[model samples]
Target: MKQLSLNDIQAAAARLRGKAVVTPLLSNIELNRRAEAEIYIKPENLQHIGAFKFRGAYNRLSQFSEQQRQAGAVAFSSGNHAQGVALAAKMLGMPATIVMPKDAPAVKVAGTKSLGAEIRFYDRWQESREEIAQDISEQTGKVVVPAYDDLDIMAGQGTCGLECVEQLQEMGMTAEVFLCPVGGGGLIAGLSTAVKALVPSVKVLGVEPDLFDDHLHSKKAGSRQKIEGTPESICDALLAPMPGKLTWSVNSRTVDEFLSVTDAEVEEAVRFAFRYLKLVVEPGGAVALAALLSG
Candidate 1:
């Protein structure tokens, strides 16, 4: 896998310009007061696909060659990435096939299909989506647009962190710390790289659900760790068994620390965002705020 560099991030920002939404950097007085520190929320919940996944997905698909674009695209995602790829491919006039777990949220599945992507459901307990995706690729001759492991996707995801730093500069404020939820580790890896590159003094922290803290364990062990059993957490988006090899490589070097939060804390944070911020944040999306609150 190729390393996502600063130049790649810059190119991603340019490629995604006018294609992806530049989500607002919001500061809640209540959260700042409660955390006893300056807090800024990059409201990715308001993004086109309702999450930051769109940044990476769009960036990756937008760079596809004419032959690849004509051949279509395939990806395996539980939720957000499915919607992101579906929407991006639709916008670019390319066909997309998404393989999702049968137990994935109905809202996400419906949203992805609404964008005209072909949906295939697999049993997470019995089948490997990676193998299924590869089979689909072989059968359909579609290019596999991986969710996190690809260099283009990582560069695209880094655009979020780039926007965060730019927003801080515009506000005449700088963050001492940056926190993001970790799953397959793409978002955190991309964000940490961008944050540390732009604001070298800022601390980049990855927040993981206690039941699915593979990134935390992997970092400590100096290798990727896979969870054998089912994840018991309500943060469905953070339940990846282990970080992607490419994402882990970037994160192992860029991220400053890791923090784990309980399922109940994630639930409360999601509820709080919905009630107070009027944002329908998924449990995984609210993990960063959960960490700040718990601390």
Candidate 2:
């Protein structure tokens, strides 16, 4: 896999400017009181489509050539990426077809449908979304946009890190550690690269559900690890069996640590976010907070 350079990240930041929201990095007083360390929440939940996926989705779609854009785009995602791609494709006036698990969250499915993307559903454990997506691509000649593995997507996610660093500077604060939940690794890979580039002193950490901790094992084994079988955690979004090759390369170099949290911990964090933060963070989205609060 080709490595993402600082130039790529900078270009992505430029491409995403004025498109993706520059989400706030607010200190969680309750969290800080408990952790005994100054803790800030990067409320990417407020991002367009209600997740950080918009940065990468818009960045990738916007860079497509006219011909490619005209051909339209297709991708496979469980939830967040689906919504991101759907919204981005709508904004770009390109047709989108999202292959999602049949059991994907109702809100996510509704959100994607609301964005006017055609939905294709398959069994989460028994179906291969890649094959289904390829079939759709062959039939419709749509461009296959990967959820996390692509360089363009990774570069787009780097914009989030850039925003975080800027927010920290403006607040006259520095994060001792930056934690993000990892799945296919796009978000953490981009965030870690940008954070290390801009704030070398800060530690970039990737949090994962213990049931699907391929990233943790991969880092330890010095090779990519793939786990077979369905994830047994409530953090369904972190269920990718292996890290993307491009994501692994970036994360292996720039990420400071990998931490695993239990299903129970994830659930607690989700409830906490809803109860205290008044944020409806899904289980996968709450893993970072799970690590922070449980540690």
RMSD in order of candidates: 1.0, 1.3
The TM-scores of all predictions, comma-separated, are 0.98, 0.96
Worst window of 10 by summed lDDT in candidate 2 = 229-238
Kindly give the stretch of ten consecutive residues in candidate 1 with the minimal lDDT sum.
228-237
lDDT of 2: 0.88
Tens-digit lDDT track of model 1 for 1-295? 5777888898999999998899988878788788898788998988898888998999988988999899889999999999999999999999999999999999999999999999999998899999999999999889898888888898888998999999899989877899999999888888888888888899999999998899889889998999888767888888898889999989999988899999889888988788777888989899999998888
Task: Spell out the clash pairs found in candidate 2.
Answer: none
Per-residue error at 218 for model 1, in Å? 0.7
- Tell me the spans in candidate 2 whose CA falls farther than 4 Å from its real position: none
Q: In model 1, which regions exceed 4 Å deviation?
A: none
lDDT of each: 0.90, 0.88
